[model samples]
Target: MSAWEQFITYVSQNGFYIWTEFYRHFLMAAYGVLFASIISIPIGILIARYGKLSGFVMTLGSIIQTIPVLGFMAITMVVMGLGTTTVVVTVFFYSLLPIIQNTYVGIIGVDRTIKEAAYASGMTQFQLLLKVELPLAVSVIMAGIRTALVVGIGVVAIGTFVGAGGLGAIIVRGTNATDGTAIILAGAVPTALMAIVADLIMGKIERMLNPVSN
Candidate 1:
C-alpha cells in the first residue's frame, strides 16, 4: 500500500479507539484545567490588585512545576491510588502556575486611565472588575488557559501508566515494548494536532476579547 493508503487504513481500523480515548483524555485534562482556572484567576487578580506576596504564590507554583512528571505520577498513584481521579488531580496541580500568573498580569496590565475613567463614572469596585478589568484582561487569562491546556495535554499522558486508559495507554505500552513506535506516534500525533487546534480556537477568542486595537 502507498503511504496514503496505509494511513487511511490505520485510521479506518483504529479511528474509534483513537477518537474515544482522545476525547476522554481531553475532557479530563480540560476539567482539571477549568478547576484550576476558576480558583487561580480570582486569586491572581487579588494578588495583582493588592501587589502583595505575588512572589510567594509564583514560587510555590514553580516548585510544583519542577517536580518531574514520572515522579509526580508515582507519588499520586501511591497517595490517591491508580485511577482517573489521581490523574485529574495531578493535572490540576500542574495547571495552576500559568493560569494564575497570566490572570495577575492581564488584570494588572489594564490601562490605569481606563480604571480612572471607571472610577470617574462612579462604577463600584465590583462593577469595575466585572466590566472593565475582566474584559481588558480576558486575552491574558485566555493565553494562560491556552498554555495550561497544551501542557495538560502533554502531561496527562502519564495517566495511562496507572491504568487510567486514555491515549496515554498507547504511548506507555509502546515505550514498554521497545518496538512500538507506531503506537507511540499514534498517541502523540493526535495530541499535537489537538494542541494546534486549541491554540487557534483560543487565539480567535483572545482577539475577540481584547479591548485594544491591533
Candidate 2:
C-alpha cells in the first residue's frame, strides 16, 4: 500500500489513540506559549521603559535561542526530570525570545510624535502605554506570538524523547518500525496542518488589532 493508504488504514484502526496524542501535543504547545507570553511581555515592557537594559536582555535571549533544542531538553531533564513539566518548561524557554524581542520592539517603535501628543494631553505614563503604545503595537506583538506558537508546536514533538507524550511518540514509533514512513507522516502531516491553522487565526487577529495606517 502507498504511504497515504497506510496512514488511512492506521488511523482507522487507531483513531482514538491518534486523537489523544494530538490533544496532548496541542496542550504542551498551548501551555508553553501561554506562560512564555505572561513572563515575556512584562519583561519586554520593562526593558523598553529602561532603555539601558535592552542590550543585555536581548543578548541573553539570543544566547538562549542559540542552544539546540535537544541540548536544552537534556539539561532541563536533569533538573526537572522526565515528564510533561520538563517538556512544557523547554517549550516555554524556546518561545520566550521572539515574544520578548517583538514586544520590546513594538512598544518602542511607537511614533515619537504620538507619544509627545499623548504626554501633552496629560496622559500618565501607564495610561499612555495602555492606551496608545500597546494599541498601536498590537499587530507586531501578535506577529511575534504567532511565530512563537508555530515554533512551539514543532518543538513539542521533541517531548516524546522524554516520554512526555505527544504525536512525536507516533513519529518515533514509526521510525522504529520496518515500514514507518506512513506512520511518521501520520504524525507530521497533522502537525504541519496545526501550525498553518494557528498562523491563519493569528493573522486574522493581528489584522483586527492593527490600527488603520495612513
Model 2 residue runs over 4 Å out of place are none
lDDT of 1 by residue, 1-214 (tens): 5544654566678899989989988887898899999899988988997887799899999999999977898898998998888888888889999999999999889889999999999999999999999988988999999889888888788788887878888667667865556667777778788878988988888888777744
Q: Model 1, residue 107: what's the lDDT?
A: 87
- Assess candidate 2 and give its lDDT: 0.91
Q: What's the true lDDT of residue 111 in model 2? A: 94
What is the alpha-carbon lDDT for the whole of candidate 1? 0.85
**Every candidate's lDDT:** 0.85, 0.91
Model 2 TM-score relative to the real fold: 0.97
**Winning model by lDDT:** 2
- For every candidate, C-alpha RMSD to the true structure in Å: 2.0, 1.3
Which structure among the candidates has the greatest TM-score? 2
Models 1 onward score TM values of: 0.91, 0.97
User: Which pairs, if any, clash in model 1?
Assistant: none
